[model samples]
Target: MDEVSYPSADVLKLTYVNVNPTNINGIERSGTLYSLIGDELKIANAVPGTRVFVYTVDGTLLTSSTTDTQGCSTLPIAGMSGSVYVVKTSSVTFKIRKL
Candidate 1:
């Protein structure tokens, strides 16, 4: 079966949604946005120096890191099989599907 996808940038943009935007100090920031790039999870629009944590379904810690100045970070998900994991940031906590 063929998979249907967004045919253009405009169509993609129209469907694109930003998650919760967080405000720190006095600045508003787009919170913890992520995209699957091959086996790497690319997170964007986070606060600079925000900490990111990946944990197993049972609450076991997997890995953790901090975002850069541009408010982005990537975590390699290649070593493990796909599963629902909890991703935590300085301002938010959410579930992430690794594929």
Candidate 2:
């Protein structure tokens, strides 16, 4: 048989690391690429006139729109509150939940 030994709690050392907290309230910020305001999905830094599509989680097409001159597209997500959907563009594809 083999015997095992364990370290005592009194001899243990703990290290603390600093962490930067982030905000996840769906607001547009420096690191946040997208934001959802009510039934409108806003994507930052997109190309102007880019085509955007919104689909259900099950791959059902809900709606589509094009970005304006400001590279922002206001998607009409009526009747999709509290539901998750997929948004896709020519350069990016991501999922967003309507609040």
Candidate 3:
């Protein structure tokens, strides 16, 4: 039989290093923004009448819509949870996370 010793608290503890965040997703920032309202994602600062696309992490197009004159568009993403998506416009693309 072999005997083993367990690691101490310090050895088993997790140490987090503060690392600078990066946008490494290859998505450029065109200053378009979005916010969540219930299950809908409301986009802001969009060019009015322009198109917006919602895609899954694998690049599947989930939905597409045009923004209203207020430079905003509300996308109904109800029932979509625990997924990361990419939202794009004619000028930019960025990643969004759903909780």
Using TM-score, give the best candidate's number. 3
In model 2, the Cα lDDT at residue 51 comes to 90
| Candidate 1 structure lDDT | 0.78
TM-score for each of the candidates: 0.63, 0.60, 0.67
Write model 2 residue lDDT over 37-63, tens digit each, in one string.
776677666777889899989999999
Worst 10 residues of 3 by lDDT: 18-27
lDDT of 1 at 50: 85
**Tens-digit per-residue lDDT, 25-83, candidate 3:** 45466567878777898888878997988999898999888999988888998887898
* Candidates 1 and 2, the one with greater TM-score: 1
Global lDDT for candidate 2?
0.74
Error of 2 at 59 (Å): 1.3
State each model's C-alpha RMSD to the native: 11.7, 8.0, 6.6
Q: Which residue ranges in model 3 land beyond 4 Å of their true spot?
A: 1-31
Error of 2 at 80 (Å): 0.2
